[model samples]
Target: MRRLLQKVLDKSQKAPTQDAPGSTASEITPQVMDGVGTGSEAVDNTQAVGTNPIKISSVQRLGFQNASNSCSHRDLGFTGKIAGKWYAVFGDTLWCAPGVKDPAQDLPGFHGMVRDSVSLLTNDPLTVVDLNLNNDSPVKHQLQFVPFNPAWGETNMYGFGGTSLCETDARSGTGAVYYLVNANDAGLIGAGVAKVVVKSGTPTVTQRYDGTKGHWWDAKTTARYGDVAAYRDERSEYIYLLGHPPSTITGWLAASYVYMARVRATDAFDLTKYQYWWGRQQGWKTKVLNVFTPETAVMWGTGQGQISWNAYYGCYVFVHLAIGGGTVHLRTAPAPAGPWSGDVQVYTAAPIDGGLVYAGVAHPYLDASGKTLVVSFTNNNHIEVIKVAFTK
Candidate 1:
């Protein structure tokens, strides 16, 4: 894992000069909004002052069955909203419907890992779903996977690296890092394998020796697990990945850590070019600080972990996981890259799951007022949407 991290850190430094093959750098300008070129100003201008608490309406599910063949929505980790429409990315499926209240039946096509008894082990396909606001979709042109077991989140989505440790296809080995691109000009076929940029990284797909019930896959090659958040802030483009590494000596330890990486707009998607930071535990006091680049410390806590941001806040919210199973609390920062403040109870229930919250995605939206924030997660087979009301 150390070797893998070193390699990725090296690659991230070398920015890609080309957008794609034919696509020029001029075509892919930094994302802009409302006369402003950066996200921060636009977010501040749109914030709802003295706004009411956000109201959440249950939208329909993507209609996928579980391992038991019952109606189940598994691992709805990351979500994105483009052009007023909502999209949820889950394991093996990408679901799309009109609004938060649209019926599940209204959603079209299952994009990945179709169910079949004979091919149970071999057919698992990892997918990421998001609505394309730039284009119109009779069925909503969603991105699909060319490789199997693709690990994705609201921010970063990439193919699993290294070899597969599963007893099923241990022979094929873990695949390389690949990105999906438009297979056809119509944008109907979804994304297909175009290139393999990084090879032999960390986090092989394998069941750990300890009997953890779920798939304990790391987002990157490191010993961390959490969601990834990305957006352009104040002329700087940032990608934040919240990772919780295995804390116990044996395989059963429950403790976790969080870290982040940042890159300038000039940098490419390569992993080496960015700066990194790790969460530290110091004799009952925990601190989240940067490990690479100009060293800096951010937040310190005994509890806070999984972090997400609202462009409206101009900062990231550090969510504290309750001990012995309780409600999650939130803390805010001026930037996703932060010197974070203390905790504030944002929601009484677990943000991701009603029983056990796993992952969440927070995106800023505009309504009748100005900027209103909506946070969504897949909790116990149901996608719960919560409206966050900011206090002055």
Candidate 2:
């Protein structure tokens, strides 16, 4: 898969000066999709973002150019905006001390100091400023708000593997950002939540709901939510979450099923208050519902994604990667729990270092001009953003 995506990436980066024999200009020339100029021309890879076909105008890689010192931790660049500034949380960071050229070559896994990290996004979400770069020695980057206390035999390479940062509760200028925790490269054991307080301007994890049960944090269960995406609806005052079972669950990748659950924004920290959508017939229920069969699943093969309202499309848009495929996909729904539109291909991510593209998310707030959208994805090393416009 990595080789295949790399070839596509190589092809898209090339500029053919002349057409091949017997080929017309249309056949040999690169046609830009969505009419958005990328400075460098890209082959017309027709794809859709929701119902409208889109043109990718530009693609920019954010943060340190070298992998030895990335701005954010490895991958999972889902975003949140506080005080009009963008912030992103990353999982399992590896950084070399200053002057190190290659961490992989000099020290293995950056001397094995891997942990979840956070960063501040500036310059219109094109630059990453590592929040923990100034911390004391031994701390590579800004660490997780809540410290991980794993049981015996567990690795420390995981925390907030998949995270979603939503709005602060109106009651307080603070809120909780939920994520998948208790995981390693082997499997994700559970999901967790931490109270986040933005102090003087920086977001900090002050506390955690360690006692939550059921869907919140269960060491025995693998069907934890909040690992995909989370959003707080301003109009309804509900925190909607999209989730999928971890790979430890049988047939998870092959039969990927996404489930939707929601809690009142104010009650997001309480797991008991959550309710799951069981279609229009069964309605929302407290009891855990069965995974939607393939015929009934709203969206499937979604490993990671983000959901945000798109005023341009007049619906909620979901940008996610197809599990095991390097292709990014977009879907739309009238509401959070929906009768969703069919999947539409938007971008094909090129794999790096044997890692397929993951964590594709749309930053709706970054695009002021409603005509275009800003989206981001990563290969677990650095964040990449692209500007796209949808055709009417």
Model 2, 33-69: lDDT tens digits are: 2112235432211122134333345444443322323
Best by TM-score: 2
- lDDT of model 2 at position 81: 64
Off by over 4 Å in 2: 1-73, 100-109, 132-140, 150-158, 183-186, 212-215, 219-222, 246-249, 252-255, 290-296
Q: After superposition, how far is residue 158 of candidate 2 from its true place, in Å?
A: 4.4
Residue by residue across 1-392, what tens digits does model 1's lDDT show? 21221111110122112111222211322211121212232111111113222232332222222221112234433332222232233433333343312223434554332110010110111222222111324433223322334232111233221110111112333211111211123221111111111113211222211122112221122222222233323234433433332222112121222334344423423323434442111101112221211111232222323344444444555444334323445556555644455455445444333355533444332332324444444445444545555544
Which ten contiguous residues of candidate 1 have the minimum total lDDT? 114-123
RMSD of 1: 17.6
CA lDDT of every candidate: 0.29, 0.57
Our tally of clashes for model 2 stands at 3
Model 2, residue 299: displacement in angstroms? 1.5
